[model samples]
Target: MNALKINTFIGRQYDSNFPEVITDAVPITNPLAVDKAYNILEENEGDYLYGFVSLIYNDVVIFGEEQLTECLLDTWSTFSYLLESRYDGSKHHIIFLDNYPYINTTIQENGQYYEIQLDQYQCFLVPIEPFKKELKKEFFNFVEFCKNEKLWFSEESSYRGLLETYNEIKISK
Candidate 1:
């Protein structure tokens, strides 16, 4: 899974390594004020600060729901219009962590090179409500609309799995 690359600094000042695709970035500070992002994040587990940007595939992942509340909240302060202007269901996404998660890219400055190490893998989808009933409700509603509208639902179409799952969910309910 190739994640959107975000340039992070180990000791504050970010470099120009930021990917052109990721237009939004955190505040340029020696130590990012992750404390300020608290309202969006679950309270800090301890004394640590870090920042992140994500390109989530969708609300649902191989893992679970793309917990975007914090990322969405931070964009209000940091990116301002990035999310609202460009929230394509599968491309733009965000997540928050109290600590640094990925290894910073190393670069040669002047004549010297440095490596900014991150503590965690930096590419994990934060674990949120895996079985969100609200999202499921929306999905089922879409499926119902499809059934009503007969969207690609002919005998030759591939809705057998969908019908089977719908039947299972119906029976369980």
Candidate 2:
């Protein structure tokens, strides 16, 4: 079993040496605000930030539906758009928490359609889901892939509930 352990830090400013992966976590209270601040810092540092851009992006991993929600909300500032966007079920996904139950459930239930996995996995689907046809295709493709692979994960109901609620939140435009 490749169970992962998570290290969580809560604050505005994040400074860590945790190997930029899922086991190491640094959840900023307000990441957008911090990002803006970091942009300023980068401007002051001249070309130095560019050198660290990969590391910087890798360091901040978004896990769970809530984290994704916060991210989508911050970016789109609306629920309907987020749901519609996710309809295609395609986005770059990176799981940051080690042994997070909700994430494990997502992986267990919805891993086949795209490159959904533990850390820094790529998904082929695009983020544009407004109609039933698109969603049905993407969703069924994932389901068929899972069946063919015969892959399954251990599930926790509470975690599943949280994810379902998170999905509802996204569509609750």
Candidate 3:
């Protein structure tokens, strides 16, 4: 398969120069995304980190491969929408997961894909069955992170409405 270069996404690189960061001074995830700046004492310190912002998604998500595929197609279809049917754009499905936080590789590298399906709870980077080629994935950067949040549970599609309807369906206990 031809590897496409995708610069846009949740964890896209803002610039070549990364601001100095010291992550997790204390335990537990913070409620908000953290992308702070710090002073680097020496140039060598720069080698240690790939500074980028990743959004915190603190939710109990129960999704399967079908849901994961749906998300992948949604993201890719939305991305390809700009083309207006001129050509077939890449689905840009995530290839592999290495259980890592930083997405510092390119579309041609391993772990590039992002859609992760699960039976329940928490985000993790687990390699799927295909074991295909992967792309570099950055965590949710500031801008993309905010943009994505806007798409969730809008007036046209409220979670409360869905939940209410779902509860109406009586399954015999």
Which segments of model 2 are wrong by more than 4 Å?
Answer: 1-19, 22-130, 155-173
Instruction: Return the lDDT, model 1, position 51.
Output: 35
lDDT of 3 by residue, 47-135 (tens): 11122222222232222212211122223332222222242323333311222321222121125433332223434332321212111
Residues 80-158 of candidate 1 have per-residue lDDT tens digits of 1121224222223223322223212111112121111122333334212221233234334433533554333335323
Worst 10 residues of 2 by lDDT: 47-56
lDDT of each: 0.29, 0.28, 0.25
Clash-forming residue pairs, model 3: 10-141, 94-113, 103-137, 112-135, 112-136
Error of 3 at 85 (Å): 12
Indicate the residue-level lDDT of 70 in model 1: 21
Leading candidate by TM-score: 1
lDDT of 3 at 140: 21
lDDT of 1 at 142: 33
Please give me the total number of clashing residue pairs in predicted model 1. Answer: 0
* TM-scores, one per candidate: 0.27, 0.22, 0.19
Q: Using lDDT as the measure, which candidate wins?
A: 1
RMSD in angstroms, candidate 2? 17.3
